[model samples]
Target: METKKNPNLEIGRNSSIYFAIGLNIMLFFTWRGLEYKSYEKDDFAMEILDIGEEIEEDIPITNLEAPPPPPPPPAAAAPDVITIVEDTEEIEETVIESSETDQDDEIADPIEVSDVAVEEVEEEVSVPFSVVENVPIFPGCKGKNNTELRNCFALKMNEHIKKHFKYPESALEMGVHGKVFVLFAVDANGNVSNIKTRGPDKKLEEEAYRIISLLPTMEPGKQRGRPVKVPYSIPIHFKIQN
Candidate 1:
């Protein structure tokens, strides 16, 4: 016996069309269930309360009488006459004269004024190395012009540093190597006044200060043809060679 195949059993042939139709039908039913609904508004009536009018009453006034005035004062009596008698005895009075005329005639002694010598105050001003007209002359840097003198001054300073460069033995033993900044001022009198030093170690600072203090007295810098203080700063480096 031979059996015939059902058309619905052949799903592979029309499965896509059937699936699309079923999905569309489900979507339509879902949209209809979720439709928006609007409510109807109810009408309301407003009521107002009535207010009564205010009433006023009139007040009455009474008349009063005033009292009478007081009586006047009495008149004053007359004064009596007096008689005075003259004295016959003579009185001698001594008159005192003013001494202001004698004081005016007398002359005061002249005050002797002694001559006092006033000491002049010298103003000590600091001038920069670059802008100073007459820079502090380093030893052996004489006879050079202003610009040449400045350059020579710097060269001489560097040469002096190298000549006197000494590493502190304590600093070297401790493996301390750093730079020290030394500041010194050449005063108006060509003498080094203030010397300051800063370094990483006390030994290094002391070495720097000693080197600076050894600097010979230089020719004082001049500004406006007058001697002034010149401040100079130099950095010294200390390093240990391998």
Candidate 2:
């Protein structure tokens, strides 16, 4: 025997529609809960004024009169007479010379240069290597005249640079290479000083400085037969081979 349930009492006939409606309702409530705001209550008690109540005070009238200020003191009387006496001591007056002059004034005497004291000051002089009367002599350089001496000096300088030239190991590892321009001064005593080096890298500059500083003390360059300081410049190139 089969017993069939009534169509009106079927539980699962509209179950999907019910579940969708319920889910939508739950989502709406959840959104509202997330956005809910609350405020602290301000418990201010308000008082009502009763217009029918009568309030009165029995205050008495008080009369006050301020006293007047005191009078000022009288002024002292001044004497009308002034005395004069003859001053016996003579005061020397300074005479101020007038800067203005007229044609009547005589012209000053011509100054003789010999009468003026002249002081001679000795100052350090620096001359260029090319124009100097005497070129600084490097070690083992000898020549008969200034022209020969300049050539020998240049040759010796190249030889010295070649002898002392070195590559910095750090520079080699870093692949740093450049041409360094070096400017140095030979002092009046023929000592190397003021060595300045500029290059693409500091390593190259330091290497140039080291090589230039190793230069031996030379005979100071002369100008007009007086030994003087000299400035020289040269370029040193650094190249690395792979």
Candidate 3:
């Protein structure tokens, strides 16, 4: 023993250490390079996203909110309603009067009444005179004679007139009895000629003529026996039964 070992030889120990250190450094650098490469890849991805965003902006973009439309123009003012008013004038009519110029002509005239006013004269009225007779001048055929001629004339006339005429109703009803004075001329032949009523009742006068027309010619009125033309007045008396 006691031999002094010779110091082991540490050959390259320092070099190895240095080398390991260098290797670590190199690995670190390689890792760092890889990280840098990843970072570059990420940067390339971001650039592509940016390019998409720009393409989107370049394409037409629609805005949801549009600009407000211009306000509508104010409505036109309505024209005023103007009615024209005209004034009318009324005219009044006047009536004219007519004048008369006839001043001198008078319309009223008066009538004269003096001559009509003269009074009429009054005269005395004379009373009429009459003589009262003592007897009827015509006492019918009293104290008469000359029978043959009287009977013959009376018969002929009575027959003829009774054949022709009739009595009137008024005379029959009134018992119109009165003297009918028939004045008929007796012709020389003894036939009655003119026949008329001399004095008679007012109503019986016509009957008297009718009756006398029935009379025969008188034997001319005789004073003694012979026929003579005498103015004979005959009386007719008409009587009715009571």
lDDT of 1 by residue, 1-242 (tens): 77898977887898799999999999998998789566555544556877878666666776666666666666676667666778988999999987666544867777555555668986668897778889989888965489888888889889888888899888898899999999888898888779999989999999988888888888889999999888888899998999
What TM-score, computed on C-alpha atoms, does each candidate reach? Answer: 0.52, 0.52, 0.28
Better of 1 and 3 by TM-score: 1
Ordered by lDDT, highest first, the candidates read: 2, 1, 3
**Candidate 3 residues 1-242, lDDT tens each?**
59655456655648888999999999999999888833455556443433344444466778799899999999999879978887687778886765554878576767678646787864422111111111111213332433544454455545555565455687777666655666765544455556778543566778667666555443334333434444344555555556
Question: Which clashing pairs does model 2 show?
Answer: none
Candidate 2, residues 1-242: lDDT per residue as tens digits?
89987989999999999999999999999999999998656766667977875668789998888798888888887878878888999999999999999999999999999999999987999999899999898878898888998898878888888999999999999999989999998889999999999999998999999999999999999999998999999999899977
Q: What is the lDDT of residue 171 in candidate 3?
A: 71
Candidate 3 TM-score versus the reference = 0.28
Runs in model 1 deviating more than 4 A are: 1-116
Instruction: Quantify all predictions' global Cα lDDT against the true fold.
Output: 0.85, 0.92, 0.54
Cα displacement (Å) at residue 212, model 1: 0.8
| Alpha-carbon lDDT of model 1 | 0.85
